[model samples]
Target: MSLRRFTDELWSDIEPIYAEILEHPFLRGLTDGSLPRTAFRHFVEQDSLYLRDYARALALCGARAPETESVQAFLSDAAGAIAAEQEMLAGFGEELGEEPLSQEVLPTTRAYTSYLLAAAYGGSYAEAVAAVLPCYWIYARVGEQLLAKSSPDPLYARWIAVYGDESFQEIVRRVVALTDELAEQVSPAERQRMRERFTVASRYEWMFWNAAWIGERWPV
Candidate 1:
């Protein structure tokens, strides 16, 4: 009998979260091109904020990696991919006539980034790898789903297409493979922590979209 891959188990734990993400009105709007402009703008702005910190987390993962190749992949290739994604988000800001750099990071965005940074700084290399996996994996999954039926709004279609790009998916696949390989070296207890971190990140994935959909802001 063959053992199940660690990622498969991680995925099974978050299947419900992924389902909710698919049903989210924000994503639904992306599919039908009916998402409000305000919400999309909010998403782009928050995403720009999110990516800045996410790049930092990726760098930490690189610094913490046991293998030199993993370190190089995270520090150079992964960081470059994030820079490209940030550029894409910047273009969206340009088209929308908004300056994301000037905007406040919403509650969800702050919480998610803080969680990732804490994981990277305070947790083990294995935990850091697990914490970052959901973002890469979930977006690629959503992108694949969105690609099957392109959006009518050119902007939304373009955004969906960015995530759906074969190149981006390849990057995500690399991360997924890395997660599985890392899991092999850890103890079962550590693997459990990895699972927990992956689940939290997955929930945050849903919350991030929901926050934009609802125009989440500081409740001052």
Candidate 2:
């Protein structure tokens, strides 16, 4: 029921996918703020799209989630996350004086969203929990780091506010704990793979943001 245990289990499920994305140098630059503004903004737009899809998946899962369920309850809160993402995105978009993004979702964003949807529709309650944990785990890590220090840029302050805040951490902690319970039944090998995916997903988050903001323009 502990947070570490939950994240550990979730990690087992998604590590390989996470690792591949993390290896990108361009993604690193984006997270660190070395990238250009346009690219970062684009990343934000794309992320908004993904968040919306994730929310949809969560909503669908809720209808099927168990009545006395801990994992389902955790996911139930997740259904509201897209609104949070949109609020953060709006603040940043306004600061840049750009028009708001359209409803269009990017292909990469769609792929990740689809993955979560598939998990929600078909994975066991525990397995479904494992499949979705990465979204929370990496946000907790990044939000911790970004919020601890003053942001070097203004746009990033909102990122700090949304991701690095206390509330988001609490959400991550709860989910990790819930998922860790499921992970206990999962094999160590599966958990290891999930960890790899967790890391890669983290990196992809960076790339996703970068692709939106500064994109391939950064020495990629």
Candidate that would win on lDDT: 1
Off by over 4 Å in 1: 98-101
In the range 1-220, model 2's lDDT, one tens digit per residue, is: 6445556544545565455544544445445656566666666667777777677666655666565566366456665676667675766667755677655676557667777777667655555555566677766765665566535666665666677778778878877776566567778766554454445445456556545643433232
Question: Candidate 1 residues 1-220, lDDT tens each?
Answer: 9889999999999999999999999999998999998999888888888887888999999998888989998888557757765786667778887444446888999999999999999999999999999998999999999999889999999988988999989989989999999899999999999999999999999999999899888999
**Residue 178 alpha-carbon offset, candidate 1, angstroms:** 1.3
Question: What is the alpha-carbon lDDT for the whole of candidate 2?
Answer: 0.61
What TM-score does structure 2 among the candidates reach?
0.73
Task: Highest TM-score: give the candidate number.
Answer: 1
Off by over 4 Å in 2: 1-6, 9-33, 67-72, 185-207, 213-220
- Predictions: Cα RMSD each: 1.6, 4.9
